[model samples]
Target chain A: MQTLDQERTSAPPKQIEDLSLLGEVSHRTAGVSRLEMCIQCGCCGGSCPSEADMDHTPRMLFAMLRAGMRHAALMSNTPWICVSCYHCVVRCPQNVHIADVMYTLKSMAIEAKLYQDSTAPDFSQTFVDMVEEFGRSFELGLATRHYLKHFPLRLPNMAPMGIGMLSKQRMNITPTRIKGIAQLKAVLKRAKEVEAAS
Target chain B: MNKYILYPGCSMESSARAYYDSLKAITDIIGLNLQEIEDWNCCGATEYLGIKLTPAYALISRNLALAAQQADGTRTVVAPCSACYLNLAKADYYMQEQPVLGQHVNEALAAGGLSYKPGSLDIRHLLDVLVYDVGLDTIKSKVVRPLTGLRVAPYLGCMVPRPDYEHRWSDYEYPVELDRLLNALGADVIEFPLKTECCGGHMTQISPDTAFELIRRLVSAADEHQADLMATLCPMCQMNLDAYQSETNKFFHTSYRMPVIFFTQLMGLAFGLEAKDLGFGLELVSARNALAKIGIEHPAEIPTGTARPKKDGSLPMPAPLPRRNMHTEKGKVVK
Candidate 1:
């Protein structure tokens, strides 16, 4: 509920105080080559749909990693803005797992408390929490909680569409849970344990 | 009847219930038997994979383990949501490509007495199975009313084609399977250049400006080509391009009411199914105008020259360029 809480007093933005995000991401993506292979060919940046909004191009971010400018790279909004489109990964000359690299960067940034854009992270945490609780995402619940928490002004604007969906029976208020949620929970717990232990 | 397991991801149950309803309505007609997995969990989507690696993989693998447990003889698992399909396929592909990842995932699986072999089951998107396995001939035979007047932009979004891992796609950047499928149904299919483009998945909920820019590009392109509606295979794409379309237009100060709909819903519509059963009115940007072109409510009338394309036949698909690493102007794919 920490992430799901609606009344978040906006925290003051801060520059990244650490410089280990690059090494941490590299460790997460070991064995099958890593981000170090990026040729800085600009393929990822070229194919990016949201590149205009990103503070650093993906290629530039890779350059930052190589140059050991961890603070600047982590502070950039590139990782958060990535839509996971995978346009760069499949198009890369060196076969860099660009999208996966972004995922790693994002997770590391959140762990280091570097990311200031809370909306994307909040949405992710809310989605994970929904899955953790019911084994499935409840749409009305997720959307309601998300908008009410982050953008209350947007809800009234969305009412007509919400009513339209409801009238068509597309909006279900109750989240249907699988019968074996206990077993699912056990698996998730063990997985978390295994991840932590590693 | 063809039998396979179905993994209707979480979206198909709630936000994409229209997809679920329409898919169920057509499977019987298409001669498919989709047996549900006994019990499954969420795929964690793109989010969980970002937050935590092992737990995310484990969360997704639980479903595969359960599906393997419930296989009974069939090994193919079909997921309707693109995100779910990609996540499921990634678990299988990556677990094999990197063995240590597999070892970690299985260790987590061992806790609940569930385990999955990387190559045990073939995870497929519903569109792939429908297009390849079901074939286009059977689909054409079943279309009671051809979508003669309605022009459609077949949008496959980003995930399904690229990073195919299994070599299942015809081309990475511009796969013509959806366009061909829509063409065979007699709709006036356009040469939509952005068919395989990104829909800024989950970005609408994150950054409205970035998402709207992406949405505006696709919507405006479809509108520019004078397409009556844009048909899609992924629910996330459909929701972003359809439900949030109004918001996107307002943000951009544009007024394009292009309707984005699921391909299966369009298939259901062409199969002579009722509009209500096909989940027509669920989209925020209503398809009434597009449907009216086909005379859904009124008497079947021939569309005027303005509504028709330059030619009566479907637009020819771009020539398949040999795969190369170099980037170009057209949809030439690197993979």
Candidate 2:
């Protein structure tokens, strides 16, 4: 059994620049390799509840990639609909790390400004902003903001619903910020240093 | 006393006040000192990152920087909110994973005169402290009233265990920490399969249908399992499952009145603390009936009709199984 440090040392470096035109934003080693480990066994697609709705299932995505259908595989909505349940990761016989790959691919697709969806990007951005602003996700604030961003027209209609939610104390209006923002900043810096070295 | 820096995030004051209150009460009893990080900010929950990557992480990193400054040699920062714990842990993990991303975030932090060294602090969920720091044995020793015959479904939600930076948890699908804790308290813990499923996160706002479908699965699963109540470590999970059960029911044209409580509340109950002290009355789905099943009655009376038979027909009887010694060293179970 290899120690965690040994595993890290033997693991391939995450090469961001090698993953298409998105350049540094796309992690090649982390994304495609995660997809490559899939034996096209369909375990992930089989277990995925959302696989039916997806244009290309996770298994098909991996199989297509292995067959050199890069454009077709990259263009599909297979990665976007993933709920990140980690069911695929847990059930994977080959330790394919599908969810992580999906995340990396999604990041790449977003950076490349491809596969633009009205709701997904807005949702992802809203999530990122919540973390950035307060060091925590304020669900009430996030839900309200996400709706406004994705469905601006729906805001007026949502107001009554929002009020109803607030009345029931289901939606909290105030946002909570984490303490010691400085230490968090340092950790980010150190992470940058490590990333730069890698 | 183990002094830890506490990051309450925003929900603790309002939506998750019960979790905040119960955590404070439980920690006080365990002789643990929790110091709140002064003037922390919101951890972009699940939205900010969806909008923009660099700025979103930078925003969360700022909080970690402040936490490090106030560390006082206690490297562990405990977050009661699942989103806070996930965001903080993700920022820390990714900063080490991607350098350019970390540099940009650090530059953003420098403007605030605060910086953090990656891995400077061990960001842990409050559940971790209770099970690991306080130890199940210690908690068991303090239980004035074992939660005799109370059936609980341990709901972890998503976030905390996944993208797990420190590997402080067990199997992602079925982490037994909370289950083990409840069992130690003598509660009849249910083996809930959807324990780690997503609670729709901010999607409850973006698309209620989508959110409702996800929430329905969890509630129905718990209901299917015939769990008396659900216990959660994440405020969002608790908030979504507890606060949205009615709306979700309306949307799905189904009825479910499952009470969701913070795990700390159950801990308080096992310790013989009054339900009110644990903020049991604050839940949208009243825990009164669930408590009544265990002979633990609450002041707010739940309608008698809501009480149903345990799914397994084993109500008021502990599941017949060999009892393992509850007090084991941390990380031993994982190996």
Candidate 3:
């Protein structure tokens, strides 16, 4: 039933256009990510606890990367859905650094402005803003501001828990700035400059 | 006594104050001498790393640099929080693995008048220090009150074990370090396959549905095992399971009350320390009922040859897997 004629008539594989995508991700990942060693194994997808929430499995995302589907890959919710549990990283037969690569994809998505939803990115940005400002995370402020911007209706529901945590002295109402705030800011400022230059 | 520099992460001062309090209550008994790293900032906790590379590493490296400078007689830096432990260890490992990263991070640190040479300090989790350094035999000897009937499910969460760059954990997927430690405290540690599962991390804020589902699974698993309570080492895991249990139940339309608490609190209980001093009532989900299961007197021993025969056609339950000894000296430091 299988004939050489059918094989000859079949279309050729799509040419990989965005070859820099893999290089960029691997380079951005810390240490040797081993992204190039991926063998299309579905271990990363299978091991992911949050795979149900992802629009594309890591394996599928890798395929898309190979096919040079930059827009589709960047817009996919796969990277954002990652919990960074490292389950896939350990389970990957090829030893691919799946979780770290997800981090890279997230930063790249933010850079290209190709993310489908603003919730995760906004949370990360807000968290970063708090860290940059006070050198510590103010959970109450983070929750209040994030909920006000995204889910105002849920604020009323969250009040009881907030009151409980506050009354229990579990969370501080105000942020605590570290003593070396000025020093940390200088280090971070220099880090940003170096990152931008590289 | 073994000495180590303590890096009590941001959560210790905030959402996980109970962990800090209970840890302090038991340290003297276990002989863990902790000198807190002064003016230590947050490790950027799983967020800043994704936003920027060099700055995030620099932020974590600052602590390492501080620890290195502050290391008097001890070169071991112990972090109680799982996220803090992983971040510190990862920064150290990566900086050593890739010299270019070390150069960039050091360049940034130079701006702060600080520089860290990779592999200078031993970055370890508090749990690791307790099991490996303090030894379970010593912990058992200090137990004046045994948690005999209270069944506990040990939850380590993510971050702590996986991506073990230094090869510290016995098995990345199913490490038994926490389980063995809890067993030493006289609690009936259950067979919890979801021990190392993710607690949805920050998804509790970004996507409530995702976090709820994951939390529901963990709670449901413990309930299925007939666990009286769940014990966790990570504050994030405890917060997600305890603070969000009601939300998870509501989302699933199920009425299940599962109490989640830190391992240190249980350790304090076993050491005969008062519950109030260990920060018992701070958990959103009340751990009172679970704590009540600890009887004032030990139960009388059952006579031998009183075993009931299995019913016809009833399948035999599989035996529990043996816990591996992860105390090997290998992989203590990566060269």
Candidate 4:
């Protein structure tokens, strides 16, 4: 396993076919991802609201997965671009769980440290950190930290709306911690253990 | 009164407080006995599910476990937020569908001295409960001040209807549940093609350009259809279209003032509840002009200078569909 820094700086690895890629993604998904059942029908791509922003459409990414192009599959920005709207999941002729499959691919990419963009992963991490800490999401804190780190220039533009939210009391200045934070944290910790064991 | 467990998500406490407030007022009028699950944590939203599967499912199921424990005589758990509803429903559905996943999640729950049987609880959205359980006839009977001429674009967003594990929707592409409910309240429901379309979700936080274009599409479509305002079921949809409308305008160099609000707020209005009680002025884009059509003006709403467009020169919009006389059969609403 290459370090994340090395993986980013080094030249692309030779395309050695990893035949388990499709099944691996399927296994990681909570329910049957049905990734192997994809017919490349383009329904997923056609129905995707964010297809224009993705490097490869979901259909193309599935084709890559079938070809065992693990490096390419993990590096593509398609999964991160998916908003999990499930438009493709309902539209797919084969009943493929396209959105859940995207989640599996995202974790895999994060595990391999092969994704091209860090914006989505970092955002997800920031959100999860707040959830772990307070047992609930802190929108004000999350937005502040996220904008300051990623889009410092856009902070001024975001101020008017922030002030409106604050003045109207739509968002709280301090995060509200849940009553069962200790219990919730224990469950999360044990969940990680179970995942590792599996 | 029909009773159930209410899983008001984290947003209900913060950004979506209007939804929470309106829900409280309307539930009293509609006779929905909603008992909140005690000490429930967040459902992990769409974020944790992307990072790790087991932990994410476990985190969401923690709420399910709590709701299950607190399920006195009611097996039903209702969530008002679309993302929260989807996550909770997905966890229950997937746990039953894949027993191995359920077993692993239960292992995590053991640490917290909790275990939830996958199929023991029924997860439903608050809209589903309002329409199906409470019945449209009941909702109509309570309308003291009908929203007669208010043209509303009933936006359900994506999460509420799609991948509907329980087959609870009218149609995935264009669900008429919200349309019919609004019509019952006397709003002129518009022909909104992007009703089930994505409202950019978390893209506003991760990628503003991508999110802005999506928001622009929904808002522009609602405007083209000549909707006075867009009424939505999800707080995220309300926030994105309401809070981010100006930013989207700046990005696209277009001025579109479409006030996005929660459906419950509108329902509260139709039921003769005070605007303050229904969280009328909290929206970033003021709904004053829209409500003014029905002779209901919010005190805190600042007046906008933009004149309403004359309907003559623009190509005629397709007439809004006739109101459906709906009846539920085996948990599915049919016209």
DockQ, candidate 3, comes to: 0.38
The superposed Cα distance between candidate 1 and the true structure at residue B103, in angstroms, equals: 1.2
Cα lDDT, model 3, residue A92: 91
Ranking of all predicted structures according to DockQ, beginning with the best and ending with the worst: 4, 3, 1, 2
Inter-residue clash pairs, candidate 4: none
Error of 4 at A99 (Å): 0.4
Give every candidate's TM-score on chain A.
0.84, 0.71, 0.90, 0.91
After TM-score superposition, the amount by which residue A116's alpha carbon in candidate 3 deviates from its true location, in angstroms, is 1.0
lDDT by residue (tens digit), candidate 1, B1-335: 88899999887876787788899999999899999887777888889988888888889999999999988889999998889999999889888878888899899888888898888999998888998999899999999999998999999999999788788889889998999889878899999999989998988778876787789899999999999999998989988888788887777668999988899888988899987887666777778888988888622222211322456587888976663322233344422
**Candidate 3 chain A least-lDDT 10 residues:** A1-10
Question: B58-115, model 2: which lDDT tens digit per residue?
Answer: 7677778878998897988999888889789877876776665666667767756766
Q: Which residue pairs show backbone clashes in model 3? A: none
Encode model 1's per-residue lDDT on A82-181: one tens digit a residue. 9988888789999887888888888777877777678888888898888888888777788789989998998887776666565655668788787878
Query: In terms of DockQ, which candidate is strongest?
Result: 4
DockQ for candidate 1, please give it: 0.33
Give TM-scores for every candidate, taking all chains together and pairing residue i with residue i: 0.87, 0.76, 0.89, 0.91
What shift in Å separates residue B17 of candidate 1 from its native position after superposition?
1.8
List the pairs of residues colliding in candidate 1: none
Give lDDT tens digits, candidate 4, residues B1-335.
99999999988988898899999988888899999998888788889999999999999999999999989999999999999999999999999999999999999999999999998999999888889999999999999999999999999999999889999998988988899899999999997899999999999999987798789999999999999999998989999999999999987679999999899999999999888888888888888898888999686753333435788879878976653322232233431
**Candidate 2: where is the Cα deviation over 4 Å?**
A1-43, A47-49, A59-76, A90-117, A126-142, A145-198, B98-101, B299-335
lDDT of 1: 0.82
Contacts from the true interface found in each model, as a fraction, amount to 0.66, 0.27, 0.72, 0.79
Q: Chain B, model 4, TM-score against the native?
A: 0.89
Off by over 4 Å in 4: A1-17, B301-335
